[model samples]
Target: MKNKKAVVYVRLKEGVLDPQGVTIQRAILNMGYDVVEGVRSGRFFELELADGNGDLSGKVEEICRKLLANPVIEDFSVEYT
Candidate 1:
């Protein structure tokens, strides 16, 4: 079987407050990189998956929604590589 990899991206949805991102943006400004107007922080998970029933994507998305991300405050996207 061929190897399969998945990357799950998790980020705050729009209109949500991101204190960490705001802090990073402030630090960048303090460092004299004035070109950066804003910043948004996010996280990703790399999953090494075994190819099984041709529905890996669906399962991954379900995993993301149920475990990796908070459906109310965060949005998630999945990428297969």
Candidate 2:
């Protein structure tokens, strides 16, 4: 029985138009931050699981694949700590 911590990160797939990121980068440049080359926005999720069997990773992965991420346009990664 182990208490597990999970971190899920979701990001837009490459080749997708990220207007928000582009806009932010432009704004940074305007603010005199010339070294800011690019920007990409993503999401982070931290969770704790109380499963005794040590099978939480599979379940969390499934949850991310099914609900947290759109398989066609997004990518996700899970880390257990």
Candidate 3:
């Protein structure tokens, strides 16, 4: 079995309030970076797969849905490399 890597990004869903993001954006503006429009706080997870071929995508998705993010408030995307 070949080893592989997967990256999972979890972020707040649309219409959800992100106070952290708002605070960061405000700080950026206060720092004179007016060009900064907004910021959204999120989570990134890197996982090593022991076996790359055994339903890798499915496993990653399951992990993201079950552990890495809150399904009701956040959405996640998976990337393999």
Candidate 4:
């Protein structure tokens, strides 16, 4: 069996205020770089899983919703590789 990895990506939802993103965008503009219009920040987690049945995806999704991400203010996406 091949090894697998689950990558969970977390980001603030649309219409939500992101102070870190705003700060980074301002700093970029202040540096005289007009090429950048906006910036958004996010986080990701990598989980190593044993080769098992097809239930790994579902488990990772549940983990993200329950612990890794805040469902009210943030959204999460998962990828298996």
> Pick by TM-score: which candidate is best?
1
The 10 consecutive residues of candidate 2 with the worst lDDT sum are 50-59
Q: Residues 1-81, candidate 3, lDDT per residue (tens digit)?
A: 343888899999998999999999999998989898979999899998886376578777888898999999999998777
For model 2, residues 14-45, the per-residue Cα lDDT tens digits are 98888889999999999999998989998989
Q: Indicate the residue-level lDDT of 33 in model 4.
A: 96
**Model 1 residue 60 lDDT?**
82
Model 2 Cα shift for residue 12 (angstroms): 0.7
What's the distance in Å from true for residue 6, model 2?
0.5
Report the C-alpha displacement of residue 67, candidate 2, in angstroms: 1.2
Q: Give the TM-score of candidate 3.
A: 0.88
Off by over 4 Å in 1: 1-3
Which residues of candidate 3, in runs, are more than 4 Å off? 1-3
User: After aligning candidate 3 to the native by TM-score, how far in Å is the CA of 22 from where it should be?
Assistant: 0.3
What's the CA RMSD of model 2 in angstroms?
1.5
For candidate 4, write residues 1-81 as lDDT tens digits.
343998899999999999999999999999999998889999999999887665677778889999999999999998878
Which lDDT values do the candidates have, in the order given?
0.89, 0.88, 0.88, 0.89
RMSD of each: 1.9, 1.5, 1.9, 1.8
lDDT of 3: 0.88
Q: What's the residue-level lDDT of 29 in candidate 4?
A: 92
